[model samples]
Each structure stands twice: as C-alpha cells, then as structure tokens.
Target: MPVYKAPVEDTLFVLKDVLGIEKFNNLPGFADATGDMVDAIVGEAAKLAEEVLFPVNLSGDQEGCTRHDDGSVTTPKGFKEAYQTYREGGWIGLSVPEEFGGQGLPYVLHTAVGEYMSSANMALTMYPGLTSGAIAAILVHGSDEQKSTYLPKMVEGTWTGTMNLTEPHCGTDLGMLRTKAAPQPDGSYKISGQKIFISAGEHDMSENIIHLVLARIEGAPEGTKGISLFIVPKFILNADGTPGTRNGVSCGAIEHKMGIHGNATCVLNYDEATGYLIGAENKGLAAMFVMMNEARLGVGLQGLAISETAYQNAANYARERIQGRALTGPKAPDKKADPIIVHADIRRALLQMRAINEAGRAFSLYSALQSDIAHRSADPAERQKADDILSIMTPVLKGVMTDRGFENAVAAQQVYGGHGYIEEHGMSQYVRDARIAMIYEGANGVQAMDLVGRKLAANGGRAVMAVFKEIGDFCEENRADERLAPFTKALKKGLNDLQAATMWFMQNAMAKPDNAGAGATDYMHLFGLVIQGYMWGRTVKAVHALQDAGDSRTEFLANKLVTARFFMERLMPETALRKARIETGCDTVMALDAAAF
Candidate 1:
C-alpha cells in the first residue's frame, strides 16, 4: 500500500513564515485563519485523508468505477463513504459563502485541505472538487433565485456538480460545439446535446448532479460568440425544490479512461433537458471561464499533490530497501549494501524532486493568496492587482506545474526500479493519475498558447508584467542577503531567461504566428522555472528568519536550505536550453510539406 502523510508542517510553515496569512485579518475570513485555526483545520483534514481516503486509493484503482446496464455508476468501494464523511465534516463548504450554508473560510484554507485529499486519493477527490468549481460559476453568474435554489445544497454537498463543455466534436474550441439549447415560454431552455468526458457525471454519491453546460441557443451567431451556459440538473426539482422527476438526461456510457477510474467520466446525453440560462445569451464562454479558472487552479494543486505523494513513497523506499553500495563505501556495513539514498545518483533524483515539489507548493499557496485578495479585498486596486497576477499565473500554474509534476511522478517510479512498473508497488498509479491533469483543464499546449497569445496581450500585458515585476522586485531586494545570494542570483538568471523569451516572442511571433505556436510549451516551462525559482528564494528568506529566531527546527531548516540550493545550482540552468529552443522559432517546425508524410 502507498503511504500518505499530509505535509501539514510544511503547509503551516508556508502559511506563517512565507505568506504571513494572519496579517490579512482585515479580510473577511482572514482573521479566522490564525495559527491555531489553521492547525486545527488542516490537522483534521490530514486525518480524513490519511485514515479514510488513502486506504481506498489503491483499491479504487484496482476495482475502478463500475457502470451498470442502467447507466448509473458506482464508485469504488469506500469512495461514497469517504465523500459522506467529507460532506458531514463540512469539507465541501470550507471556502464557500456563509449565505450558502458554508463556513465562509478563506480560499487558501480550502486549497490546503484540497492538497491533502488529492495527495491521498485523486480520483475520489474529483467528486467534490468539480462541485466546488461549478459552485464558483453559479455563484458568479446565477441570478438571486438561481443562487438560492442551487448554492445551498451544493455547498452542503447534498448535490455534486460537473462542467459539460466538451462535445463529441470539440474540446477546447467552444466555437465548434454542436450542443443546442432552444428557448421555451416559461423562460427555460430545452437542452439537447451530448457532452463527452464529463467527470463525476453519473456518480451515485450525490442526490442530484448540477451540470454547468455550454450550448448555443436557436439562431444564435456562429462560433464562440454564440455559446451560452445553462444550469441543467439530472432530476428536475419540485415546488419544494427537492428532486422530483427525472430530467431528459442520462449517462449514455462511461468512458474507459487511461486513469482516474474511480471517477466516472461519462458521455452525457441530454434530450431536451430542462435548463435555465445563467448569464446573457451568446455569452456562455464568459461565464464558463469563471469555472475554468477555478478548475485550472485546482488542477495545478493536483499536480503538486501527486508529486508530493510520489516523493514521499519514493523517499521511503530509498531509505528502507537495500540497494547497491555507496560510491564512497558501504554505510550500512552490517547489511549487504547501503541504502540507495547513499548513492549520489539516487540522491540527485530524489533531491531534484523534493526541490521542485517544495517550490511548487510555495508558488501554489502564494497564488491562492492572490486569489483571496482578488475575491475579498476591500480596495478595488488591491483586488485588481491580485486578479491580474492570478490571470497570468493560472495557465502557468496549470501547465508548468503539471508538466513537471508528471516528470516527478516518473522520477519517483524510476526510484523504485522494476518494482515501480508492477501494479502492486503502486507507483504506476501515480504516473497514470498525474497524466490527466496536463491534458484536462485545457491542455498544457493550449495553456502555453494562451500565455503567449491571449494572456500576454491581455490588458496590454499588464498581468504578465505584474508577475515579472513581482519576481524582479523580489530578486533585487534579496541580492545582498548573504544567506540567500545564491538563490537570488540564480533566480535573476532564470528571470532574465524568461524575459528574453517573452521579448523574442514579441519581436518574432507576431510576424509569424507559428513562431509562438512552435515555442509556446518551452516558454511556459521556462516561465514556470523562474516562478518556482523565486518561490525558493522567498522560502529561503522564511527559513533563515526562523533560524535567526533560535527555532529548534535545525535539521528541517537545513534540509530546506539544501533543497533551495539544489533548485538554484542544479535546476535553474534549464532556462538557457528552453530559451535557446524558443529563439529557434518555427522554421523547421513548419518546413515539411503536407505531402511529405
């Protein structure tokens, strides 16, 4: 069985030392996220993850979700119960609105709790995770009546949610979607469509499934401009708003996917399902984006969560499993060979994984803080600034984090040698589960293009510049700190590399669009490296502060310092290679004629 101990200590450190989350007391829920409150909340979340979810993870993978002849799906054993425990504990409403029957906590707290659940059982986590994102969309776009009718039950976890944007014909390009919504006399539409790859689409855990779907109204304009969002439920509500009659919706079939078998990815058939428009006509994409952004950030958290779990299991095996002798000599002379951790090569792999995981956590939490500010800050300027940062970083967070996160999973698997490949050892499951995050929530390639194409040019590049400016300012301020000089220096180098790539795209990609398309992925990765590098720099500052204050966590602090150094010295140099590839542009990429193949 795989082991999962939530990184509560690390989370607490980042919360207090790095983010200083308590200082945001002026914000509505910020005051409650005090040291004790955070500890109590996250500590309980950890137990739930470890005790309830973690045990079922491997079983969930093995048993998978079962789809019956009737099209109803049954989650793997223990998944439903785990979700019940989760909802009863008020986990679903951790950051939801108090008006919606929630605890009204800061979003950051929910994010931390999410990380624990994800690390423990990603497939099971999707049930509530998708609900949270759907709730975010309805809360933003829904009318007062709509909010009152849906938000309370969804918040309380009596109902779960799913986003149904993809059709048989399209995934990312909403313009090509063929789903249709026809207007009715009672101000509701009859939605008739088939949406594929709908996660949590037919799960039995919830009493009702609220689908935030995208479709075009009759005679609407062509392409994305005509797209509209609708609230469609599996069962229509009665006068008391309880689920009464079955709607014209059913799971045509659940997809046999590569991973995440515990969550039913369904092909949903809506034969004129009763639906209500949430936002304006021909404006579905705008409303859907609210859910998309929320889901994107959540996916980024998935990346880090998987990586953290993989690292923990791999590190445990390295210490306990007997392996080849150390390059220096056998440290465990009594045994036949030293543990693999003593080998420099093994150390290199483990250290790099640890370095990236640590920094990625910081980046994610910082982004979450920005989200909190954007959503809750009293000052419009503060909110806008935070929103700008969040907008630019969302794609970066999803794309780069998942890309490296999958790499980390593979690295963890490699640590176990042949045992990793076999199913019983459980490493293969991590790799399989981590792979979906990159493809969904907008694939990493689309993410990179968005970074270069839309986001870079959004608001005349204010958001991207805001992120760069923050990193630049951090690098400059810490340049002279003796303890942090190495990190600051390397971070500056990566920052320069990212800037050069951005500037190159500005000069070249505009003239030839393929230039941006060809190099988008590289630029995104390069940008991620610098952002994570800056995360390390900030973390070093925090750790050094603790060290100076006579804190007793000497070994922990030392390990963190080592990880920071590894990130700067050994890992930060990849920016150069990525920058070189970015400058090469689309010459060779588009050289081949269509007939050549």
Candidate 2:
C-alpha cells in the first residue's frame, strides 16, 4: 500500500520563512493566521490526511463508485464517514467568508492544506474541491438570494456543487454547446441539456447537488455570446430554503474513467429543470471561466500531490528493497546485497523528483499568496499587481506543474523497476491518476495557447512584463551574495531564455499564426522554468538566513539547500532547450500535408 505524510514542516517553512505570510496580518484573515494558528491548522490537516484519507485510497480505487437503478450514486467504502469527519471539522469552509458559516481564513491556508488532502486521496478530495470552486463563482456572480440560499450549506459541506459546462458535443468550445433554457412565467427557466464528465456530479454523501450549468436561452444570439449560466439543483428549494421537490435532473450514467474512480463522473441529463440565471443574459461563459480558473489551479496542485505521494513510496522502497551492490563495492557487506538507494542512478532519480517537488511546493504557495493579496488588499494598485501576477502565472502553474508532475510520477514508478508497474505497490495508480491533471481543467495544450496567445498580450503585456521585472530585480539584488549567487545566476539565465522566447513569439507569431501554435507549449514550459527557478533562489536565501541564525533544523535545512542546488544545476538549464524550440518556429511543424499521415 502507498503511504502519505503531509509535508507540514516544509509548508510552514514556505509560509512563515520564505513567503513571510504574517506580513499580511493587516488583511482580514491573515491577522488570525498567527504562527500557532497556522501550525494548528496545517498539523490537524496532516493528521486527517495520514490517518483518515490515506488508509482508504487503495480500497477506494479498487471499489470505485456504483450507480443504482434510481439514478443515485454511492462512493466507495469509508468515503461517507471520511467526508463526515471532514465536514464536522469545518475543513471545507477553512477559507470561506465568515458570513458563509466559515472560519474566514486567508486562502493561502486552505491551499496549503489542500495539497495534503489531494495527495492522500485525490478522488475523495474532489468531493469538496469542486464545491469550493462553485462557492467562489457564486460569491462573485450570484445574486444576494443565491448566496444566502447556497453558500451556507455548501460551505458547511451539507450541499456539494459541480460545474456543468461540457456536453456530448462540446468540451472546450462552449460556443458549440446545445443545452437550452426556456423562460417561464415564475421568473425561472426550464433547463434541458446533457452535461458529461461532471465530477462529483451525483452522490449520496451530500443532501443536494448544485450544478452551475451553461445553456442558451430561447431566441438568444448565436455562438458564445448567447450562452448564460444557470443554477440548476437536483432538488428544487422550497420557501424556507430546504430541498423540497425533486427537479428534472438525473444521472444518466456514471463514466468508467481510467482513474479517480472514487469521484462520480456522471452524465447528467436535465429535462426541463427549474433554473435561475446567475449572471446577465448571454454572459455565462465569462462566469463559468471563474470556476475553470479556480479548478485549473486545483488541478495543478493535483499534479504535485500525486508526484509527492509517488515519490514517498518510491523513496521508501529504494531504502528497503535489496538490489545489486553499489558500483564501487559492497556498501552492505553483511546483507545479501546493497539497498537500491546506495546506487548513484537511484539517487539521481530521487533527487530529480525531490528537487521539483520542493520548488513546486514553494511555487504553489507563492501563487496562492498572490490570490490572497489580489482579493484582500486594500490598495487598488497592490490588488492589480497581484491579480496580474496571478493571471499570468495561472496557465504556467496548470500547464507546467501537471506536465512535469506526470513526468515525476512515471520517474517515481521507474525507481521501483518491475514492482512499480504492478498494482499491489500502488505506484500504477499514481501514474494513472496524475495523467488526468494534464488533460482536464483545460488540456495542457490550451493552457499553453492561453499563455502565449491571450495572457502575453493582455493590457499591452503588462502582466508578463511585471513578472519579468520581478525575476530580473531579484537577480540584480542578490548578485553579490556568494551564498545565493548560484541560484540567482541560474535563475537569471533561465529568465533570459524565457524573455528571448517571448520576444520570438512577439516578432514571429503574428506574421504566421502557426508559429504561435507550434511554439506555445515550449514557451509555457520555458516560462515555468524561470518562475520555479526564481522560487528556488528565494528558498536558498531563506535557508541560508535560517542557518545563519542557527534555527536548529540543521538536517532539514541542509537537505533543502542541496535540493535547491540540484534544481539549479540539473533542471534550470532546460529553459535553453525550450527557448531553442520556440525560436525554431513552425516551418517543419506545419510542412506536412493533409495526406502525409
């Protein structure tokens, strides 16, 4: 069985030492997130993940989920009880506004804890993860009544939520969607549509499911401009805000997916379901993007979560499983043979995953802090800058994290040799589960295009420019510090590669659109390398500071410094390759004829 222990101490280091989260105490929830409070929250979440969630991961995957004749779905064994524990603990509402029956903490806390939950059991965590996204959308776009009716229960974990966008004929192209909503006399619409690939769509865990669906109103304009968002519930609400009559919605079938089998990915059929519009007419796509953006970040974290879990199991196995003797000689002369970890190749693979996982965690928390500042800061300029950074980094986070995360999972599996491929060790599950993060929440390809196509040009390139300047300034400020020179120097080199690729896109992509399409993925990864490199620089500085002050975490600090150095030496150089690919443009890529295949 696979084991998972939340990186609580590492998270605290990132939160308190590197990011200095306490600096934002003036912000509403950050004030309450003292050292003790943050420690308590993260430590408790770690206990739940290790004790409650990880135990059921393998069994849940084996049992999967079952759909009954009555169109009701049941999660695997122990899931309901686990969910109940999660609800009673007020974990789902950790960062929600207090008005919505939540603790009203900074979103960074929720995000930090979220990695543990996802790593423990990704399928189970999706139950509340999707709900959090829906709550964020409703908070921003829903009416006063909608918020009052839905926010509290969803926040309290009684009622869960799902975003309904894709249909039988559409996945990314919302304009081609065929779902329709007809206006009624009572100010509600009759929604008739079928949405597929709806995660946590129907389940027995929650009292009701609120689906934020996109549909076209009768006689509305064509294409995406006509699409509008609607709140369609499984059970219609009564005057007292309780679930009353059953609505015209049911699970048509549950999808048999490759992984995350514990989540009820349902084909939901809506037969004239009573629906209320959330946002303005012909503006549903914009509102739905809110959920997608949140989900994209969550998906990126899933990549890291799977990588972390897989790495742990692989590392543990490497230390215990006896393999060939070390190249030099017998490291364990008394034993039958030396442990796999004694080999240089094994250590290289482990360090590769370790290096990325550490820097990836820092990047995730740092990006999350940007979200907190973007939403909570009092100054408009601060908010704008934070939002810009978040916007530009979102695609990079989603695209590069998952891409590399899946790679790390495979690498972890490779560490176990033949044993990794077998189901008993549970490494296969990690690889299968990590695969979906790259495809969902907008495929990595779309994320890449969004980065190069829309995000780079937004507001005359202000966001990307701001990020570039931040990295450049960090390098300039830290050039003289000998302890930090290695990280900053590598980061500066990576930043130069990323900037050169961006310039290539600006100069070449416009003349030939195929150039943008051909090179977008490389550009996205190039961007990710620099961002992660920048995070490593900060991590090294923080570790050095802690060591200088004799913080007493001698071994942990030493390992972190080594990992940061590994990242700089081994991974940061990939930016040059990505930049080279981007500069190659699309001539050969697009040269193939339609009949070439």
Clashing residue pairs, candidate 2? none
Alpha-carbon TM-score of each model against the true structure: 0.99, 0.99
The lDDT per prediction is 0.92, 0.93
Q: How far out, in Å, is residue 580 in model 1?
A: 1.0
Q: How many angstroms is residue 175 displaced in model 2 relative to the true structure, after the best TM-score fit?
A: 0.7
Write the residue-wise lDDT of candidate 1 on 242-341 in tens digits. 9999999899898988888888999999999999999899999999999999999999999999999999999999999887898778899999988888
Model 1 lDDT-worst window of ten:
477-486
Task: Write model 2 residue lDDT over 1-597, tens digit each, in one string.
Answer: 778889999999999999999899989899999999999999999999999988999999989999999999999999999998998899989999999899999998999999999999999999999999999999999999899999999999999999999998999888999999999998999999899999999999999999999999999898999999999988999899999999999999999899998889999999999999998999998998889999999999998899999999999999999989999999999999999999999999999998888888989999999999999999999999999999999999999899988999999999999999999899989998999999988999999999999999999999999999988999999899998998898999999888888888899989899999999998998898898899889988999999999999999999998899889998899999999988999999989998996
- TM-score for candidate 1, residues paired by index: 0.99
Say which candidate scores most in lDDT. 2
